[model samples]
Every structure is written in structure tokens, then in C-alpha cells.
Target: TVLTPRVTLQVVLSRQYGSEGRFTFTSHTPGEHQICLHSNSTRMALFAGGKLRVHLDIQVGEHTNNYPEIAAKDKLTELQLRARQLLDQVEQIQKEQNYQRYREERFRMTSESTNQRVLWWSIAQTIILILTGIWQMRHLKSFFEAKKLV
Candidate 1:
């Protein structure tokens, strides 16, 4: 099972998928995805093996598509197949660009928030320093007068 970033659960294979299998899924949003595998092994089996071995090969974007299979299924000519490949590549490039834009927007927002906090902190620090200086000056003047030194 795969947990998409959007909180959607996609069950690739509910039953045993044999020795080798391939599953493809399209991501609607650009974010981290979680893959989970569960086995129905009994406690004794689990203790004996200590671990479950899984070989997963994940290919994202256009590489996941089988161009040869597509060409054969569609009975496409060489030129048509080339065109189809180009179109898929272009679509992947667009998705990549959109993801980059999303990251840039998030980074800009964080930078602005940090800048605002730093500006307010600096202002507060300056005010505290000014108030401390005034308090010390008044205290010194009072002490000198009481001692008859001024």
C-alpha cells in the first residue's frame, strides 16, 4: 500500500503479488509519499526470519511509462511513437516546473515570516536598552547628591 501526500491510501495489491510485480501511480501533488508493506506471516515465521526482504524499484515521472508496450498496443508508426514520447516528456517537464514554483512560494513565505519576527525582536531589544540606560543615569545622579558629591 502507498500513502499519498494528500492522505489518500492506494492499495496496489491487496493479495499476494507473487515474486515480482510492477505498480504505477500518478501523484497529483508534489510531496513525500509513504510506502507500506505488510506480511501475513505468523509469529513463529517472523521470529525465525527476523525481517521481511523486499526489492522495490520506484521510477517516477516519464521513466515509469513503457513506451514500447504503448506503441505495440496502439499500433503506432515510428513517427507517431516518437511524437507520443515527446508529448509525455513535455508533460513531465511541466509537472516539474509546477513543483519548483510551489517550493519557491513556500520558501518566500517562510523568509517573510522570519524577517518580520527579527524586525520586531530588534525593536524590542533597542527599547529595553534605552530604558535601562535611563534608569542607571537617574540612579547615579541620586547617589551622588545623597553623598554630597554634586
Candidate 2:
């Protein structure tokens, strides 16, 4: 089972297979994802001391595409296949750029929010200091006048 960054569960292999398996999935959203593997064996007592070993080979971006398969499936000539590869590369670059833009926008919004909060806090502190000074001066003036030391 694979859990996407959005927390959506996708079952790569519902049934138990051999020790080795290959699975692939396309991610529509850009974020961190989780992969989980567990044995669903009915006969747990068969091998109580047996250990399960998993080897994962994850590929992303341009490497994820099986170029030979694409070429054969599309019936593309050598030139056509090369052009298709270039196009795929360009498309991947565009997607990466869009993701970078999204991250930049989020960072900008966070920075602006923090700056606004700091500004407001400084203004509040200034106002409090001014009020305190005024109160102290008035109290001292009354004390001096009462003691005939004005």
C-alpha cells in the first residue's frame, strides 16, 4: 500500500505475490508520499522466525519513463522517438517550474504575514510605553505639588 502526500491510500498489490514485485503510479500532486508494505499471510505460524526483506528502487522525473516501451508503443522512428523524449523532458521541466512557483508563492505569503505581525507588535509596544510614561509623569507631578515641592 502507498499513502500519497494527501493521505490517499493506493493499493499497489492487494494480494501476496513472490518476494519481488514492481509497481508504478503517477502523482498528480507534488509533496512527500509514504510507502507501506506488510505481509497478509494467513499462516503466520508457518515461519515464526522468518524475516521479511523489502528492496525498493524508486525513480522520479525523466528517469521514470520507460523510453523503449514508449518508442515501441508509439511506433515511433528513431527521429520521432528522440523528438518525443525531448518533448517529455520539456514537459517535465515545465511541471518543475510550476511547482517551484507554487513554493515561492507560499513562502512569500508566510513572510508577509510574519512581517505584518511584527509591525503590529512593535506598534503595540510603543503605545504601551507612551501610556506608561504619561501615567508616571502625572503621578510625579501630583506628588510634588502635594508636598509643596513644585
Candidate 3:
């Protein structure tokens, strides 16, 4: 089965799939994706305790494209198609690398923001604690003074 973030592209349900499965999905969203599978939930399989194994071979970005098909489609000679494929692959690698860097930057920004919030929270808590302690001590002192015990 293949899925994009907003929709399910393909699903093979119930019927037995082989040990190996190949699927390609092009992601327009730069975030995370999920590839999920589960055993049949039918009464028979559940009662029998059936087990399943799935092997996935996933290729992303430009590697997902069949260069031979592209070449044939474009009617390019061997050398030109090979060069085109290499250039395309390199371009894809650069895109993936940039995506990783973007994620890291976003994570770093979030972490810094969280750290700032925590620091401010800690400061506020400490100030409240100190003020409460002072207020309590003053109240205690007044009570003792009125009773002439201090």
C-alpha cells in the first residue's frame, strides 16, 4: 500500500502478498510519512493466531524513477540517458540533504523556544516561592509581637 500525507494511494487488503513488496510514493510534503500494515483481523485468522511477515524495499526521490523508462520515453541514446540519470540522481540527493538540514534547523529553533519558556517558568516559580516565604514570615512575626512572645 502507498500513501501520501493527505490520502491513501493504494491498498492490498486480505489477499496474501509475497515476502517482498515494492512501492514508490512521491511526497510533496516535507514532513514525516507512515507506511503501515497489519495482520488480517478476521475471526478465523484471529482464532488461529496467524502470523505474517512483510519485507519492504522502498526507494525515494529520483531513485524511484525508472531511468530505462525515462530514456525510452525521451528517446535518448545510451550515453545521454546515463548522464541525465546521474544528474537527476545527484539533484535528488541534494534535495534530500537540504531537507535534513531544514529539519535540524526547525528542531533547534523549537528546542531553544522550549528552553526559554522553561527558564522563565522557573524564574517565576522561584519569585513566587520567595514572596510567599516573606509573607508567611511577616505574618508570623506580627502574631508573635502581638502575643509578646518575640
The 10-residue segment of model 2 with minimum total lDDT is 7-16
Top TM-score prediction, candidate number? 1
Q: By summed lDDT, which 10 consecutive residues of candidate 3 come out lowest?
A: 8-17
Tens-digit lDDT string for candidate 2 (60-94): 88889888999889888999989988998999999
Estimate, for each residue in 40-95, the C-alpha lDDT of model 3 and write its tens digit: 44558645776655667776777677888988899999999989988998998899
- RMSD per candidate (Å) reads 3.0, 3.9, 4.6
lDDT of each: 0.82, 0.82, 0.75
lDDT of 2 at 107: 97
Q: How does candidate 3 fare on TM-score? A: 0.67
Report how far residue 102 has shifted in candidate 3, in Å: 2.8
Kindly list the per-residue Cα lDDT of model 1 for residues 84-132, writing each as its tens digit: 9999999999999999999999899999999999999999999999999
Using all chains and alpha carbons, the TM-scores for the candidates as numbered come to 0.82, 0.75, 0.67
Please list the residue runs of candidate 1 whose C-alpha ends up more than 4 Å from where it truly belongs after superposition: 6-22
Residue 80, candidate 2: alpha-carbon lDDT: 93
